[model samples]
Target: MLARSIIFLLLSLSACPLFAQQKYIMTVRGKVKADAIGRTLAHEHIVTNFIGAATVVDVPGDDSVVIAKILPQLLRLKGQGINTLIECTPNFIGRNPALLKKLSELSDLNIVTNTGLYSAVDKKYLPPYAFTENAAGIASRWEAEWTNGIGGTGIRPGFIKLGAGSSALDSIEAKMLAAAILLSRKSLLPIAIHSGSGQAAISAFEQLKKSNWKPEKLIWVHAQNGTDEERAMLANEGVWISLDGVSEKSWEQYAGMILFLKKRNMLHRLLISHDDGWAVLENGSYNKLDLFENGNSIPYSTLFTKLLPALKKAGVTESEIDMILRNNTGDCFSF
Candidate 1:
């Protein structure tokens, strides 16, 4: 009887969800403990091919030139104390896990990639099959990337990324959201959606509620585009408010938004970043990289050089800043 009681107690503890799960975030290199991702810029892009999915061609060969152009910026970011960067360029829009992995190795920074389709800009970035495939089918593709690895590179995605074009979720966007929810449920990865507007963020949140998905799993990327009321409402609903797109011009506005949320005790729900990246300009016979005209003269340094100082001037404590840059980011991306 004593042996049986001990065996049952052990089995019960093993079956508990808390004991059964281990928390970690997937990086281009591999998985790391959640606490290890220090001072993460929650959203940024390495390189984006805006040539659209139909005309975009993967120019095979060494990515030396592209790496040459972008590597210095990443190294500088590492110098600025940013330990991890969440690369937000979705698959068709130049989601290169292999390239990200190479950059990560070269710079010694934790770079994360995503596994989902971008359906924004009138579905220009989406592939042909995205239209014909159902939600389950689309989800299966993303889930396979999470389980196995992206495109056989053996590097997995850390989260799900979806793009919405407007306030009303169009058919393709709705389908993509459904697929994201499905994949998130299966893989335990957070879903970050590029909301085109405030209503779009609300719409996505409502849909998640209808699907019975946890609001904490949904990140409203580009939440800076939304109003304070909208941001407050969604933050109250447990959605991760990603106030990305910080730049030299926008740091003050971002600081104000952060303080507003801080006043409401919603600082823990915020994620901040510079939506800074390079746009691949493909000519007839050559490709060139153009710094995104997002108002940051520098690539990834404004958050440290400009915004944080402004927040500090406004009396935002270091621990509160850490909550946004370190704790919130790790929690949002960790599975």
Candidate 2:
């Protein structure tokens, strides 16, 4: 009887899922459990060279120049208890997986990068080949990156980064969004779309719904660009509303936005970030994006440094703060 009981116990233990507690968020190096990701800074650009190399804005075309400029800023983020940064530079702009891997190693931060293409206002940023690819074709490309790692770097993307016009998605943007929806349905990875405007989010959600994708998987990046009513609409539908671009100049505005979600009891769906970072190489150039020169106070540390306290002072509880800064992002990026 003892032997039989031992055998049954062993079988039951073997059948149980290991790593059940670790829901992974893909980074430049590899995957880290969503909870392990620690105080995350969602929606940032580690390397961004999307606009034409207009030889003017002191674009550090060299890797060394990029690294020298940004590592200190990242070190500051680490000092402030931030462990993970969601680098949102997409393809055709400045998404470099390898450099991101290097930065992760150097900074000891879990850096989650993304797959998917950016939309061209007039097909400007998109490569010529993008015009030829249909939604499925484009989706296949992104899916392969998610499955097999991006561009032979062995670094997989954690989420899909998509963009659109403020009012509506253009033809190419629509096709790419469709492709993203297809991939999201297949893989169950989260999709972060730059909500250029309220109409863009509505239109994209409509199409995604037709495809039978869950609204929970969609993230409205730059959601603050829309009005309160528009944001409420998206937040009500169970999508993520990212109010990332906060500075001392705008923390109150974001606090108000948080309050907006709180009143609706949908604060868990909110994601906060700086949406700003230093970049070079037109993507992950390792150059820090310093929006805080000459008394501009939009540093990456605002979430921990300023915003959290303000949120608390504005009547947000500690648990709610954790929900926004940690749990919400962990839940959003996890598969």
lDDT value, residue 204 of candidate 2: 83
Model 2 misplacement above 4 A: 1-22, 53-62, 279-298
- Residue-level lDDT of model 2, residues 1-335, one tens digit each, is 99999999888877777724457787787778777788788888776664542221323345676566667778888988788899998776657787778778888988998888777455556666678988899899999999999877788999998878887777888898888988988887898988778888888888788888899999988898887888888888988888988876778888888898898888888899887764343333344454423122545766777778988998999888777878889999988
RMSD in Å for all candidates: 2.4, 4.7
lDDT tens string, model 1, 131-187?
999999999999999999998899999999999976678889999999999999988
Tell me the deviation in Å of residue 277 in model 2: 1.4
lDDT of 1 at 262: 88
